[model samples]
Target: MTSDAGPILVTGTAGFIGFHTAVKLLDRGLEVIGVDNVNDYYDPNLKEARLARLGERQGHQFHRIDIADGAALNAVFTQSRPRRVIHLAAQAGVRYSLVNPHAYVQANLVGFANILECCRHHGVEHLVYASTSSVYGANTNMPFSVRQNADHPLTLYAASKRANELMAHSYSHLFGLPTTGLRFFTVYGPWGRPDMMMYIFTKAILDGREIELFNHGEMLRDFTYVDDIVEGVVRSCDVVATPDPQWRSDVPTPGTSKAPYRLYNIGNNKAEPLMRVVELLEQRLGRKAKTIMKPMQMGDVPATCADVDDLTRQTGFQPATPLEVGVARFVDWYRSYHQVA
Candidate 1:
């Protein structure tokens, strides 16, 4: 069932979520044009390997270009003329932004700007970009909702994503470019980022080393699996956003607008405790983790829970993978990939 939409363009196709999304689209028999600089943010080899897997699939194309390079990005969009655009490339990592602020400015800000510009000029029908749960910063809200106010962000990384949402809204309003932004919650699974908690903890535990338990292992997260995130992303991409007819300026909804723009939180509604996640990982690995409990670090949220009602209503998308199953699968992949018993 090949799509008449021609080739789909996926930016940041080498990254974790982007890679999964690109794979899903390719599996659906759509030609995927993947663009990634393959930067060594964590490990370039991992990025290269992910790209290799995508390359193995028929109808998958790869391009090495930084999205911040306006000229390069424009040329790609012009040549590809993709019907849909999934812009996921960015300088990710909250704590890392503390050390390298410019990276966020270049990748998140400039790169995103370049993407929006290209999408606008190229008449992209649907623009699906990745936002983050961190945008709900400093709020005491449980089960974070996309319709809530997210003006206050806790980190440079979160702020950058917030800016992206605003930037997308403007494009949708002015250019009639239907756009959807997904605020992803603590996504993890097989082939996940090495910098993420699950991967770090699993590796440390397998090596008989102590794993740092931030916030004394009392934190909670909506640990959405990569597969579920990919599913939500692909579904959202297929559904074009439309302006909310009921939107009122006096009582504006943060997640919807009079423009053809919408935002949804693609996350597991269940917030699993950090200690429970570790326990599940240990159970899966058949090894005890030496936990080094410590206070929560800066740019860290103690808890995150997503309310995906809007997502469900819009796309009927619900995260299906349980923490235990996801954790077990991650451990299986980690053991085989790292050659650990």
Candidate 2:
């Protein structure tokens, strides 16, 4: 939606999802202020490449600043005077959390607090931030639902995101700031992160290397396409969260409250086996992956399926991108981006 109000501020513009989100906003003829440090998280080159693409678009302003630096982040808010915000910046990676817990604390915790304060003081109409399905840690439910309690986060990354949902709720209650937290499942597509399973498997297979299938390739994941995730995010930004009239104190729901705060699971709503993805990639790439079975690693869930009924009801949208279609698109992009023969 094109807004006549002030520009929309989006954090993590250099990131995979953030880059795609910024493009969506810009294409809609909206002024987009992009904030990103372009850190050496995975590959600064790739981040810069994404930034270069955004720079070509009209109505896009880029700022190189870290969100953890509250002063710098506040400066952006004061200067841009954004009408709304979409926060996607965070220290992502479950295994990386084990090695560097401080990173998660600084980026996810301190950085998020700065964002909340900015929105509170700057009169942001709605704050839509990214959460992860990893918050459903230790819950064996077939399909993860926002109504269910997400109290046991296994990794620091997951715990930090769960904390963001709680932090957003507090702001909504105290300052009347509307907030929406979307717990995303495994998002994959073009311009995907190299650390994710899809990217790693694709690269290794193309290079004639063995692709490790953790948990013996038996894992089921609701692998959402990036375009679908961005659609849900943009729609949530358009629909400001309102207090649930039916909310009760005696029997409170986890996803909604009396305040203008809500949470929704944005996913494909179907769990596909890990091997299914591999097969799709093989078919697209014209090469079979040398598969290696491996045990489950620490801080990883065995399966994830999203219950997107609430998202559908609220946004009139459901992530319906089939795994086969999405994988084929990713492979095509990978080949083009890498300039492979």
Candidate 3:
């Protein structure tokens, strides 16, 4: 079925990646049912603004509901009967997890359980959920691949995300619910989270404030742009996960399964050094950022790169955004939207 004909349910519509994905789906003539709790994670106003933009579109329907509420989630599922579900809502952030661990359990665990239940009951064609590269926790693999082992998660946040992958796999095996888990790497762009690196770095630089250079600017990140991530997401939604005939229990691939479940990484194939990103920002904004070099914090990895070849081969999805071009566009958007100099 094409996007234009049926409705697709997208969770966390107010969030960065969710907002971009919903916008792209709606633009493709899809009827989008968007949901978000509008929690004060960063700024609820930004979330509200994102909702406003979605509301302006003709085929979009929004509900300010918490996914953790099972009854509420079921009610919406019964009413909408969405053909596909994109589960993006979660208690997001690595640093914040250190302070508010309960938030991660409630939103990421409980909310995700609710979404899986709804999808299972509704007989959704595909259930595409967000997993994080943070799940690669403590793995120093040069380019993180779905085929690699990811058992040693560092933070509670990573653990929770890893839990999501397992949860999806369970549902896929038991209920035959097609599930695809996306391990996203350092997504950033316009209308991005104010707490994210790009927004924080750009804001601090513009305001003549010092930007914290974690790991002494020696970190490397895939830094996938929001648009590229959204494209990969939409294409994945179109291709339902299938059980691998070659998947033997004796030797299993971490990416695929004998059940109707799969995992893929959406990231820039090219990794950019942390310092290089700062340099780009400096050049784009014509402002010199006061830098503060610091050792790596706990629950933080020094680098993350994604091997997205599986995604390309399976769904014909490839992230094509160049770092310089994407960064420049983000800078332009930040200035225009925030009225920054």
Candidate 4:
């Protein structure tokens, strides 16, 4: 599905995945209209840095607006007239959701509704949005698959994302909008979010601060690299979703429907122990982390693995970055970005 009609609208372009996804799109000679609030969710400086990089690209145009503001977002849609919308803007973080539940409501739920309306009205070719592995909350099933039951979300963050999947299905059914929801798992690499496990461990290890190992470091994560994630996002964006003829109302699956809606998991597909990640960081940084064991916090999962079979079958791509290589890249970026000798 080619969209030569207008630029691709990518929300949250200043974010880790969005930044990389925009670069990939621009590299493919596509005109991209990037949108982001650049909120102080973490460090605005880092967000600015990512935006600056995107701004350097010739085919890229940026708008500093929050997706929660329906009017502002709609204006961008009016002016840009994007054929495809990559909606990645949302209040991200499971633990933070516990503290600021309203942020999740405003950004994930309300903001998503606004996005859906814009896409529906603007005649978007395909709307690819970020979902999360967190939606597989409280499910002890190994290698989480999109076809499984994901109704039991453990936090507002997870619930909000799960809601996005359902909300997208409605648009696909009602408005004939093609929507694809990507469930990303433990994404980390250069320009990664500071709130994520990779950044936290690297910073604590470098500063010689005690890093708390939740679940006594027994947690397992898919730990996908940022580049691998970008590949999935871009590939998925190019493929417009179609209604599944195999979909049955009686024996329905969450991944596909009779509507033009689909869900896929983007992850390394191999779960690695959390401590193994720490060991890799220690090896790369040449410093042993000052670690303290802690019980798993509420709304936190002990393990996450992705079944990327659907994503692979659809896009002919699967996340293959090894944890060691990915950790090394992140550590290198952290050292340079923080100006740590």
lDDT of each: 0.92, 0.94, 0.92, 0.92
TM-score of each: 0.98, 0.99, 0.98, 0.98
Cα deviation of 12, candidate 1, in Å: 0.9
Give the best candidate by lDDT: 2
Per the 3 Å backbone cut-off, how many clashing residue pairs does candidate 3 have?
0
User: Over the stretch 135-174, how does candidate 4's per-residue lDDT look in tens digits?
Assistant: 9999989889998999999999999999999999999999
lDDT winner, 2 or 4: 2
In Å, residue 19's CA in model 2 sits off its true spot by: 0.3
User: 29-55, model 3: which lDDT tens digit per residue?
Assistant: 899999888999998888888889999
Model 2 misplaced regions, further than 4 Å: none
What are the per-residue Cα lDDT tens digits for candidate 1 across 215-333?
88889999999999999999899889999999999999989999999999999998999999889988998889998889989889899999999999999898899998899999999
lDDT by residue for model 2 over 1-341, one digit each (tens)? 56585699999999999999999999888999999988998988989999999999999999999999999999999999999999999998888999999999999999999999999999999999999999999999879999999999999999999999999999999999999999999999999999988999999999999998889988999999999999999989988999999999999999999999989999999999999998999999999999999999899889999999988899897776899999999999999999997
- Model 1: lowest-lDDT 10 consecutive positions: 1-10
The whole-model C-alpha lDDT of candidate 3 against the native structure comes to 0.92
